[model samples]
Target: MLDFFIQPFFEFAFMKRALVACFALALGSAPIGVILMLRRMSLFGEAMSHAILPGAATGFLIAGFSLPAISIGGVIAGLVVVLAAGAATRATDQREDASVAAFYLIALALGVALISMRGSSVDVMHILFGSVLAVDEAALLLLGVVSSVSLALLAALYRPLLLDGFDPDFLRSLRGTGGGTLYHLIFLGLVVVNLVAAFQALGTLMAVGLMMLPAVTARFWARSLPGMMAVAALIAAVSGYAGLLLSFHANLPSGPAIVLACGAFYILSLFFGRVQGILLRLLPTRHLEA
Candidate 1:
C-alpha cells in the first residue's frame, strides 16, 4: 500500500510536476473560492473562469500554447470582464450578477470562435479539459509565481477583504468614494491570476473545480472563516495527492480525477461532516425518539 501510494510519484518526473502544480493550485485558489463563496459569488466566479478563455484562446491562436502569451491573454481577458462588470454594475440599475453573466457569455463565445479558427477540435477540448500530467517546468514556474503573489496579496488585504466579505454594505459606507474599489480590483486581480495559473494545469472549465469544491466542503465542517480556509486547503492538498494516485492506477485524466476526488470528499462531508453533516441532524432525531 505504501508502494502503491509512493511509487508512481517517486518514479515519474511528470507525476512529480503534476503533484506540485496541483498543490500550488490548491494553495492559491482554494482560499479565493472560500472568500467568493462567503460573498455569495460562486456563480460569478464560475462565469469568470469561462471569461478567461477568450484571451487564452487568443494567446493560443497567436503563440501556439506559449506560457507567457497564454497567461497574459487570460489575465487581460479576465480584467476586461471584471472592469466592465464593475462599471456596468455601478452605472446602471442592473445587478452585478446579470452584468457578469452577460460578459461571461460573450467571452465564452469569442473563445470558442477563436479556438476553432486557430487549431483542431482537439485544441478547443484541451482548452476546456486540460492536461495536468503534461505540466512542464515553465508551467510549474508560472503556477508558483501566481501562488506566491496571490498569497501575499491575500495576507495584505485580509482585514479589508474580510470586512467586505461579511459586512460589505457597511464597508462601503466607511470607505467612501465608491468604497473599496481598489481593494476590490486587487481581489479580482488575484482571482484572475489564480485562474490563469489553473488554466495551465486544469484549463478554464476544470480549474474552478479545485477552487470551489474544497471551499464548499470546508463550509460543512468549519465554523469560523480561518477554520474554513485551513480545512479547505488541507482537503485540497489531500485531494491532489489522492487524485494523482488514482490517475496513475486507473489511467484517468489528472485534472478531472483531482476534481472528482474533491467531489467524493464533498459527498462524504455532506452526510458525515462534523459541523453541518446530515448525520448530525439524524443524531437529534434519534435522541428525541429515545
Candidate 2:
C-alpha cells in the first residue's frame, strides 16, 4: 500500500501536477469559500460556476483548448453575469437569487450548445467531468500563481471583507457611499477566475463542491473566522491527498473521487463536530428557575 501510494509521485509528472494543483486549490478556495458563506454569497459562487460555461465554450472554439484563453473568457463571462445580475436587480427590484438562477441556466445551455457545435460529445463529457489526472506543469504553475495572488489579496482585505461579511448594514451605514461594494464585485470576479482555472482539473460541478464543502464542514468546528479558514484548508488538503490515492488505486476519476472524499468529511462533521454535532443537539437543555 505504501509503495502503491508513493509510486504515483515518483513515476508521473502529471500526478505531481495534480497533487500540486489540488494543494493550491485547497489553499485558495477554502478561505474564500468561508468568506463567501459568511457573506451569503455561496449561491453566487454556484452561479458563477454555471455562468462561466459559455465563456469556456467560446474559448475552446477560439483557442482550441488553450487554458489561458478559456480561463480569460470564463472570467469575462463571470463579470458579465455579475454586472447583469446587479443591473437587473436594480432595474426590476427582482431578487438577486432569481437573476442568478436565470443566468446560470442560460449560460449552461449556451455553453453546451457551443461545445456541441464545435466538438464531439466526448469532449463535452471531458469538460464537464474534467481530466485531473492529466494536469500539466504549466497548469500547475498557473494554479500556483493564481492561488498566491488570491491568498495575498484575501489577507490584504481581511478586515474589510470580514466586516462586510458579518454586518454589511453597519458597514454601509458607517460609510457615506456603498462602502466600495464594487470591491466585493471584483473579489467575486477573481473567485470565478480561480474556479475556471480549476475547472480543467476539478470540473464545474465538483469544483463548486470542493470550494464549498470543506468550508461548510469547518464551520461546525470553529468559532472564529481564522480558525474556520485554517480548519477548512486542512480538511481540503487531506481530502485531496486521500482522494488522489483512492483514485490511483481504484482507477476512478480523480475529480469525482476527491469531491466524494470531501463530501465524506462533511458528513462526518455533521455527526462529530464539536460545536454543532448531533450529539450536542440531543443533549438536555438547562432551565433557570425564576
Candidate 3:
C-alpha cells in the first residue's frame, strides 16, 4: 500500500513535478472557483477555458509547443475575450453570459481551425487533453508564478469580491460608477491565469473541471465562503493525488483521470455532503417548539 502510493513520486521526477503542479493549481484555482460559483458565473470559467484555445494554437504555430509562448498566447487570448465580452454587454442588449458564450464558441472554432492548419489530430489531442508526464521545469515555474499571483490578487480584492458575490448592486453603489468593474476584470484575469496554469497539467477541457467541480462539491459541504474555499482546495489537491495514482496504475490519461476524480467527489458530495446533500435533506427532522 505504501509503495503503491509513495513509490511513484519517490522514484520518478515527472511524477513529483506533476504532483507539485496539481497542488499549486488547486491552491490558486479552487478559491477562484468558489467566487465564480457564488457569483453564478460558473459557466464563465468554462467559456474562458475554451477562449484560450485560439491563443494557444497561435502559440503552437509560432513556437511549436514552446510552453512560454503557448502560455503567453493563451493569456492574451483569454483576456481579450473577457474584455470584449464585457464591452459587448455594456454596448448591446445582450447580457454578459450571452456575449461570453458567443465569443467562446467563435474562439473555440477558430483555435481548432488554426491548429489544424499546421498540426495533425494527435497534436490537437495533446493540446486539448494534456499529458502530465510532459510537464517540464519551465511549465512548473509558470504554474508557481501563476498560482502565487492569483492568490495575491484574490487576497487584495477579497472585500470587493465578497460584495460582488453577495450583492453586485450594493458593491457597485459602494464603489460608485465603475467601482466594481475593476475587481470584476481582475477576477476574470485571475481565472485566465489559473486556467493557463492548469493547461500545463490538464488540457483545456479538463482544466475547468479542476476549477469548477471542487467548488460545486464544496457548496454541499461548507456553509461559509471561507469554508467552501478551503474544502474546495482540499478536494482539488486530493483529487489530483488520487487521479495521478490511478493514471499510473491503470494507464489512463492524466488529465481526464484527474477530472474524473473530481467528478467522483461531486457525486459523493451530492448524496452525502453535510450542508444539503440528498441524504441529509431526505432525513426526518425533529419537531421544535415555538
Candidate 4:
C-alpha cells in the first residue's frame, strides 16, 4: 500500500507538476482566503473565480497561445468586472453583493457561450473542472510569479487590509489615505490572479472552494489570525498532494478530488475542532443529565 502511494512520486511528471502547483496555490490562496473570510467577502472570491472564464477564453483567442497569457488576460477581465461592479453599485440602492452576483452570473454565461461556440469536451472540462496533470512549464512559471507577487503585496498591505477587514468605519474616520484604497485594489487583483493561476488546475468553481474551504475549516482550530492562515495553508497543501495521489490511484478528476479532500477536512473539523470538538458535545450532554 505504501509503495503504491510512493510509486507515483518517482514515476510521473504530471504528478510532480500537480504537487508543485498545489503547494504554490495553497500558499498563494490560503492567507488571502483568511482575509476574505474575515471581511465576509468569500462571495466576492467566488464571483472573481467565475468572472475570469471569459477573460481566459478571450486571452486564448487573442494570443492563439499560452495558458499564462490567457490567465493574465483573465485576471485583468476579472478585475475590470469587479471595478465596474463596485462603481455601478456606488450610485444604486442595490447592495454590493447583489452587484457582485449579477456580474458573476453574466460573466459565467458569457464565458460558457464563448467556449461553447467551438470548444471541445477537453476544453470545456478544463474550464469547468481543471487538470492538474496537464499543467505545462509556462503555467508553472506563471504560478510561481503570481505567488511571489501576491506575497509581496500582502506583506506591504497587511496592516491596512487588517484594519479594513476589522473596522472599515474606523478606517473611514481616519479619512482616505489613498494608500488604503490602493492596497484594496491590489489585493483584489491578487485574488483575481490567484483564481486565474489555479483555474486551469482546479477549475473556476472548485478553485473558489480551494480558496475558502480550508480557511473556514482552519478557523475552528486556530485561535489567532496568523494561526488560521498557517493551518489553512497546511490544509491546502496536504489536500493538493493527497488529491493528486487519490486521482492517480482511483482514476478520478484531480480538482474534484482535491475539493473532496478539503470537504473531508471541513467535516472533520466540525466534529473534532480544538475549540468545539465532539468531546465537548459529549461532555455537555453528560453534564445536562447530572
Best by TM-score: 3
For 17-102, candidate 4 gives per-residue lDDT tens digits of: 88899999999998899999988998899899989988887876666446766777788889879898988798898898999899
Per-residue error (Å), model 4, residue 181: 2.3
A best-first ranking of the candidates according to their lDDT comes to 3, 1, 4, 2
Which parts of model 3 are misplaced by more than 4 Å?
Answer: 288-290
1 or 4, greater by TM-score: 1
Per-residue lDDT of 1-290 in model 2, one digit per residue for the tens?
Answer: 67887888789777888888889998998888888888778887887888888888899999877888888888888788888888889899799889988888898899889999979988798778787887887778888888898889889888777767777777677763567485577578668877887787887767777788898999889989999999988888888888898899899989999989999999988988887788776777678611
Q: What is the TM-score of each candidate against the true structure?
A: 0.95, 0.94, 0.97, 0.93
- C-alpha-based local distance difference test score of model 2: 0.83
Instruction: List residue ranges in candidate 4 displaced over 4 A.
Output: 173-177, 278-282, 285-290
Candidate 4: clashing residue pairs, number: 0
Query: What range of 10 consecutive residues in model 3 has the weakest lDDT sum?
Result: 281-290
TM-score for predicted model 4 compared with the true structure: 0.93
Clashing pairs in 4: none
In model 1, the runs with Cα more than 4 Å from the true position are: 285-290
RMSD list, candidates in order: 2.2, 2.2, 1.4, 2.7
Off by over 4 Å in 2: 284-290
lDDT of 3: 0.92
Judged by TM-score relative to the true structure, which candidate is superior, 1 or 2?
1
